[model samples]
Target: MTGDNAVNIGSPQPPQKADVLARVCAALSAGDADTAKAIIDTDYPMVIGTKAQRRYTLTETLRTFYRDGFLDRYSGTQLIHPGALRTLSMLLPKEFPAHLNGKMTETHFAQWELFPTIDHVDPVARGGADDASNWVTTSMLRNSAKAHWTLSELGWTLHPPGDARHWDGLSSWFTGYLTDRPDLASSSGYLRRWLRATRVVQAERA
Candidate 1:
């Protein structure tokens, strides 16, 4: 962290994956459910169907715009399935060990490392407007770390937005996952609604 008037620290580098894991380890070791839940929700957001159905479909389409992949605007880390994050959060504390690992495993990736989140470029608390122009896609970890802080205060630079031509945020993988695990959506209203809405967009794009 630097002073408000500190010289440029260049772009903000994301904390090492090890550091993130260590933090989670500490929280779980202390049996801090609230802290852990905060981490889970911040990192892997669960859909709440806040957007109108048509709006949600449009949002998904923009996400898949040009088949662009997702990247954390602050850390530039690739993100994975939000649905998986929800599942991991549900299975946590009691089932924590099965997911924890020394090496970065698939479970860790989805739960901690690469879960996508939307971030406000300016702090809403500080009068940043709540609109798309003020928003950027980021990982959950970065979002939590940046809560209400300005980019200057954090010594972070805004990375260029992701181009779907190069990275599709593993969307193709998600589509395939849906095909292989249709039952997942059947059980999750969030997933079911997303599937229903995106299907319309997917067809149009096809």
Candidate 2:
């Protein structure tokens, strides 16, 4: 698969809420529940663009959402950039768990004003040696969603939604936890850690 067809660089313009939603849809269509969860769990903050001034309040809201299982039921159909949608479809079935079957489709593609745009590069230019190298280099970005989401859940008690501090803390915690459990690493693990750390941090803050 060519890189253009395999991964979406997105528009040079910053992604809007709709754009991100489309990406989530594409991720789901590809049966990538993990990616979908990461989008909701991590990108929501980016979309909200909140500051770090009220760490404790922000963290609490995020933790509450997770604790209440709001996220588990937040599934929906979304539009995706065509390249990304195709790429994700090719990738997800091989990688994701079976429980998320049929979650991705074009049915809701237009509902959220999310749609795919064509990229300049040939999507097929994505899987050769150079592509492989680039993929490895970029793998960190893909792997980070789960870590960021986990950290967000954990740090929710300290930072507000969209706070950069929360993202930083999530990255730090993810790195620390993944160092010990590389094989067990996943969005689910991140959620569990968030729950565990939230209690610990709450006690400290208390």
Candidate 3:
């Protein structure tokens, strides 16, 4: 058996599915919709809600919560799960008027159960008061199950966490994942452009 401390620098390790998922989550957290789109394209079909109660473009869905200006409006600790995504896709557009563009408070709880993680309260206090960590909490099994189901439905295979990879640089990371996937790149490119345009518009206003 290989020694536990052994280092095999020459060995080739395939990318793990968790690594990709984590990257996708991180990109979503960072408001990098391009990366999110690329990841989604490789894993699932962009399903828009057809019912009057639920209607939105995939772009709009991502934009509503993951976009730069709106991200901070929602709590970051809440993760998006497939079930919640499906539910939200069905519920959101129908609830709001077309001209009144904004998010509501209840939307935060729209997909809470879908998260694999449980929310843990922090013991540490900060700023002369209580500070807590209200992040998702769940067992590893549940997390893997959610990821597996999502990928399987999308006709994709998942890599094990042991084989996952990470990069500290965002641009390099995006380029690496997107370079060979032209179809994904194309779908994500418009979002990237939209983000850039938004930034430009904000800068001009500032």
Candidate 4:
């Protein structure tokens, strides 16, 4: 398959998620829920952790991804395209942001002991990348507040969202997360929303 058609999760690939992607795709394409159910049951372990941690079951994990706006295709508060949704993006390093912003002599932290999470300035729902340029350091509260909403859409006037110039730079350096995850792209209703927004902006500018 071409690079545009599938998510390339880097070679020396791991198992689990990759193995299920193919099976789920076939089931969905053929409208076979029975096959899909069987695939998920066998593919994703109901529990995780070496020390017998009772984490999310596959169903639970899928539900979370959909609820959290991670997947492009969601049904109310649940995932529709389990195959396309696949897995969450790889986590970034905690110190990586500090290192990237190293030129700054000062750093700000709103919450003590709160780990940094990667957040998109433009938002994937409104067209944004998943890489360094489009990413910003954020706490869980900030990230949750910013969930799937664009800076302009929310009328926020602080930090990266407040800075129009930063968003412009990110737009120029753009590569949407969906570019890598084509499965999500195929079902992303976000594209239509983005297009409508774009047309309105263009019309206003004109």
- Ranking 1 against 3 by lDDT, winner: 1
RMSD in Å for all candidates: 15.1, 23.0, 23.1, 23.3
Error of 3 at 59 (Å): 1.3
Find the number of clashing residue pairs for candidate 2. 17
lDDT of 1: 0.60
Where does candidate 4 stray beyond 4 Å?
Answer: 1-113, 158-206
Give one digit per residue, the lDDT tens place, for model 1 in 69-178. Answer: 57777876766545444444444634532243423442443455566666668766666666666767777678889977889879999877676646655555555666
Whole-model lDDT values for every prediction: 0.60, 0.35, 0.36, 0.41
Q: How many clashing residue pairs, candidate 1?
A: 5
Model 3 worst lDDT run, 10 consecutive residues: 160-169
Each prediction's TM-score against the native? 0.55, 0.17, 0.18, 0.24
* Clashes found in each candidate (C-alpha, N, C closer than 3 A): 5, 17, 8, 0
On the 0 to 100 scale, the lDDT of residue 87 in model 1 is 45
lDDT of 2 at 144: 30
Best by lDDT: 1
Candidate closest to the true structure, highest TM-score: 1
